[model samples]
Target: MPTYSRFLKEILSGKRDCDVKKMINLTENCSAIILNQMPPKLKDRGSFSIPCAIKTLEIGNALCDLGASVSLMPYSVFTKLEIGDLVPTNITLQLADRSVKYPIGKVEDVPLRVGKFIIPVDFVVLDIDEDAHVPIILGRSFFATAGAIIDVKQGVITLKVGNDSLTFDLTNTMHYPSSPSENCFFVDSLDPLVHDMHEHLLISNDPLDLAILNREGLGNLGVEVAKYKEQ
Candidate 1:
């Protein structure tokens, strides 16, 4: 073996030892890998859902989607519950596909029974086909009202209400609903149009004018008239 002149000189001079092992520091990641101390790889647990009810009618599973701004309910479900009258809302929803969907109305303070807790939730009623598996989408509004703390790694979700708390294990209870033909959509924008017609519709006591605006005013305002089905 051909040794470098510098190294040979150092070895002969007794300044450096040939058989000495030098210690080097390793990064935390590298040390973990070498020592097999890395965390165990976990598989995708899927979407979080919980069994909730409105009165005696048990809604199968409600998908807890953080991406949605408003808690959404199909008009069909609202009718089935027959809980209360839907108040007219000026808020307009723009979907993920950039399509505008007009909500039928807003249902306020509907009691949602989850486990031992009866929480009040406001839902934006939309005219859309209800999913058999997961009929309702619980968004940030519901989460905030319920005080939801999602633990993605542990696959657990904790819902706190005052001094009480309820935790659901997503690993065991997670719902994997069969993929529907409709693309998954979320509310991307809220009340985009600042038109006078929308404002008038809000305060207009004349049913005839409100009806006319609901039919033609949105289209006339350059807002694309699209149904939730298209989204």
Candidate 2:
């Protein structure tokens, strides 16, 4: 059976007897945090990668982006999930390169399964490039709510949920494609055009200085400078 069909069937089936929200409470010792750590790799190519689950379905390629304010997902993924009903939003996202893309809208109550933790967040649906390698973009919205701690050197992302720390390793899954900057985050042009007034040209405050260039000839040259009296 298709994943989407199953999801809809379950939704239509009925609500389960549960608290709904993933809950966590800590003790006085703070022993609940185990310092979720990943094994040190012989050759660690630091990349922000983590496994994300939507409706308990693991998203193979999910990129962890700290620069982004809100979590984002391609509209294509939304269509694949067959999730219905999204709130209308008029938000404009500015790319790293300064270009902007408008999102279709936002879907509330979207829970992302990160490790054993359930991250309740919203995603702004947008039309992403079809060729985009990463299907899901985990932005700061998830990070802040999840209390994520990413260790770049160790290539690990850990989320402190309640008293447990859920971890995902990047060394095994994240692929560092050639010229990644062009693929994921927008790359700003190093050389930007700077505008300034040409220094060589100067205006004469006194028409006496321009007396050398006859005003009569200036009219013939299709050039005239406005004269102002010194206050």
Candidate 3:
């Protein structure tokens, strides 16, 4: 059995040595940051929840998920709106959790009144009956426009609109279940090299403390390999 420290080391080294199953068990049960191990009171402490409204209807806690490409507005919110001009769209969407298809109507530019600001946003209308809590999903569109830095661990969402800034307290935060078997690995993020280490994660100690994120994928595999060798 691998200890938490050992597993952490393996992850840093990109060493996928342990069997998938055992590696997950160690992370799920013994990790210091295990979600289920936290006190119930601290569950909502680290979240990025905010309130938005359309006309008189209060849109529930809008989850700012940077992963999602499109902002989702449930049918419930559309029904509450005093005015909605649904343009005809032949768009079919496959939600994250399910494989079933959702018939999407035309996008609506909904004027959302968030705090002191009135931001008009284009929302993809869909019936999200599957999701129990999230009524509105603020995707990349919101982040790009608002310039929000969503730090989940610190439980802070700092939004920068030009020179002005605003922060919101999260309510009904997301909780991670002890389901290591389901999610075991994370995608790699390249940061500026501070120290040269043997781990493949960082090739070498470079004078520049910044590295470009691997967004282009394996297309430049040979170049990356040569860079690593040179380092």
Residue 167, candidate 2: Cα error in Å is: 1.8
Q: Which residue runs does candidate 2 get wrong by more than 4 Å? A: 1-46, 178-231
For residues 1-231, could you state the per-residue lDDT of candidate 2 as single tens digits? Answer: 898787767777764333369668766445434554434457656457676688845677777788888888788888777666778998999988799999988888787776678778788899886434577777887888888888777777788977898877777765666345556666565443221212112254345445344544666332333442331
Model 2, CA-based lDDT: 0.71
TM-score of every model? 0.64, 0.56, 0.50
lDDT score at residue 90, model 1, on the 0-100 scale? 88
Error of 3 at 103 (Å): 3.2
Number of the top-ranking candidate, with TM-score as the measure: 1
lDDT of each: 0.83, 0.71, 0.64
Model 2 pairs whose backbones collide? none
Q: lDDT tens string, model 1, 40-92?
A: 98888788888889898887678888889999999999998898899999889
TM-score (C-alpha) between model 3 and the true structure: 0.50
What is the C-alpha local distance difference test score of candidate 3?
Answer: 0.64
The 10-residue segment of model 2 with minimum total lDDT is 193-202
Candidate whose lDDT is highest: 1
Alpha-carbon deviation at 2 in model 2, angstroms = 99
